[model samples]
Target: MVSLPSTLERIRTRLILLALFLMPWQTRWIFGTDTLSGGISEFGVLSFFVVEGLIVLAFVLQPFIEHHRDFDGAVTLGWVMMLAMLASVFSASNPHLAMMAWLHVLGAYVLFLNLLNRHVKPKEALFAFTLGLVAPALLGVFQAVTGSSPASTLLGLASHDAMTAGASVIETFSMRWLRAYGSFQHPNVFGGYLAVGLFAVFLFLRWDVSKKARMGAYAVGALLTATLVLTYSRSAWIAFVLSSVLAGWLLFLHHRVELRRVIPLGLIILFVMGFTATLFSNPYVVALEETHPGREVYAYQPVHNLYLLMLSELGVIGTLFVLLWMVLIDRYIFANLPRVGAVGALAIGSALFIIGFFDHYLWSLWPGLALVAFVLAMTLRLSEPGVEKE
Candidate 1:
């Protein structure tokens, strides 16, 4: 009888893994706009909601049926963030949209930190995440190389016209380059996703895995880095560089890796930067730069600054809530840095802080936000040395 229940629990854990793997590819359907034509677009994704339902159900069942109750500070902070979001909705210009946004963010936080963390091993969860990114990374590489992506439409992936006259293009001194959108609304968002995947690959490589597994991690890391470069997202580029340097420095300080090994990593960084600069010098990139200022926020001037965007959309109280959330994350990372490993802690921390500065994706985009939650969950899990099963 006990064995039967254990078997059922294992099955449930597998289902959770399947749902997490597919969450990134879930598509949304826009029902209506809050205003006649220009306000918040109300959207629904049945699969997303279904997955959230399952995660919440598992969380609820665990405490009662399994007699499990293990709550951490991260979970508490997440609930606090949810409450803040609820309060912010009252002052939101579009309360319905605000509520919906809160639900999405809360759902992601619960799915990763509460449910997935309880069921899966940290390494397994990280591997599943890296697997989920493979398809999108390949799509991005193909789009960048071919200058088009008809496959995105066939696969129901989100994409914009890269070759359109006024589309998303990067202009350099002499050329214009079409940025790879992959399965995201923007190249910057795609870049952010790849950056996280790259970090996962790095962690996989550092693990005491088989040689074949290490080689696979290397391949995946290279591909992800390539697509990240093709994204031409200045924010992502800056974030990756800063995060890598910080992580490397921490590794050295902790003596986790020898200083001599860091030299090759430094050379690789230089090579990547040099290659990206060459891409930026293309004629198309130059043309776009000369013609397009690349600042467009809902038809007005682009507010590239994330803090300002949060203030405008979420108001002062909501913005303060977000700032508080960031402070908590920083505290958690610093407090657990040694246990989490310098690479894991600094990589995720830098990505969140650096990317948050330039883009609203952390606040608005579901996939980007979900990645943040996943990284945080993984960091917390890694800080502890064993599987957190009850």
Candidate 2:
């Protein structure tokens, strides 16, 4: 008869092999060449809430709740915060529309939390997460190099989807295409996703158990950096630099590494100079000046007003509540880094912080917000003691 230890070993081996089989990440979805049928069949078709429902049931039915009981309070608190924001939207003019929008946000977060907890371990989460971005990263590279857009045939995403169309292509000295948006609906979203994934890879390089694995982790990190640059997202560009500094500082307290000192400073200088240049060099800057007297009209009104939008939608009190949550997360991670392992959690937190700047990422109305929520949940869970099971 096989002993319990031997039985566990067999299961572990099978799980590792299964993860390896799914490493490429691009195989999960199909892309297409045109809009209409392709978009309708792919993007317009599936209900992400259906996916959330199944996972919620699975979590509810777990026989030994004690195994995951530590996280129950945190998770419950997060849900309450989200529900409160939804209630505010319901108080708006259009009740039906507000409810629909709120449901989308809630459903996305639930799906993210559920999928992450059910499917990913701390070690495998990075790999599984990387697999999610691999296809988009590769396609984004191809798009950058060739200036060929992925055919809008299958995944149902197109160049004109509010996020991708006008701002997708950025003119550069090297004749660069717009940053590769990949599977995301827009370049900014793609930039946000790529930036987050690359940071995870960077953290993995620092914390991975095996020497051989570090090489692969670093390679993925480099690829993600390249993808982030090519996407030409100025907001993302700024966020990456800021988050890297914050992440390095957090991780340095725990690990005391040399490269962390060098890399963040270099990135800060590079991104600051480049982003400054882009702002001045773009002809659109001149066009905006011509159309609107004050630069604030172009800069602060629509694009740079994410915080103002938050205040408008959630009101002053609600906005403060959300901002306080951000502060709490930072304090929690800082306090718990030694017990929880700071590398990946720090990187994930930094990436999300950066993503939140230009986009209303914390709001959770968009589908990509689900991906961000998943990263946050995974980071929080990994940071918690005794969360990972054998």
Maximum-lDDT candidate: 1
Output the lDDT of residue 322, model 1. Answer: 65
lDDT of 1 by residue, 3-37 (tens): 86566677666666665665556354444445523
In every candidate, how many clashes are there? 14, 8
> Which parts of model 1 are misplaced by more than 4 Å?
1-8, 36-71, 151-154, 171-176, 256-289, 292-302, 340-343, 385-390
lDDT of 2 by residue, 230-300 (tens): 67666677677777677666556755664553464346445644553453344333434555557463142
Q: Name the 10 consecutive residues with the lowest summed lDDT in model 1.
A: 39-48
For model 2 the TM-score comes to 0.69
Model 1 TM-score, all chains together? 0.81
Instruction: For each candidate, give its TM-score against the true structure.
Output: 0.81, 0.69
Clash count in backbone of candidate 1:
14
